[model samples]
Target: MKTASFPSLRVEPKLRQDTESVLYDNESLSQFIESAVRQQVELRKANTEFLARGLASRDNARQTGQYVEAVDVLEKLQNRLDQHKAKHTTK
Candidate 1:
């Protein structure tokens, strides 16, 4: 893989020491920071995909006229639970 250099950043001494403590003795700070950045980017990408899927589901529900108010949905669930309890309860 091709390599690139980053401009120096000024960080607090304690923070730098903390980061170095977690890295292997032979690992450069740049490598550790790069790996962390890649992981964060991947996490953000996954979050974006999840949000897109949720929005698509909402859109589909709207298009089908299947969307209900939160209160209505909660009430329906409560009704089902009450019916279930009534059926199982004796006397």
Candidate 2:
């Protein structure tokens, strides 16, 4: 596999100790930190993509006049909940 180097990070003493303790049993600290950084970067990329898609969907809904106001949505949900509670309470 290809290899890359990361600059040294000055972490808190306790954080460094915790990382080292977890890494001591299996892999080197460098490998653990590299894997962690890579995972974080990928996670952020996925989150950005998800937010972009959601915004696009909202824009489409708005353009089609399909988007309901927050108050309207809340009222619908509240009505449903009230109906559900009424039914269950009487049973």
The number of the candidate with the highest lDDT is: 1
Tens digits of lDDT, candidate 2, 10-63: 989999899888885669988898899889999999999999999998999989
The CA lDDT of each predicted structure is 0.94, 0.90
Worst 10 residues of 1 by lDDT: 3-12
lDDT of 2: 0.90
> Which residue runs of candidate 2 sit more than 4 Å off their true CA positions?
1-3, 68-91
Write model 1 residue lDDT over 1-91, tens digit each, in one string.
9988778889999999999999988899988999998999999999999999989989999899887799998999999999999999999
State each candidate's clash count.
0, 0
Worst 10 residues of 2 by lDDT: 21-30
Candidate 1 residues lying further than 4 Å off, grouped into runs, are: 67-91
lDDT of 2 at 47: 100
The C-alpha RMSD of each candidate to the native structure, in angstroms, is 8.6, 6.4
Error in Å for residue 21 of model 1 = 0.9
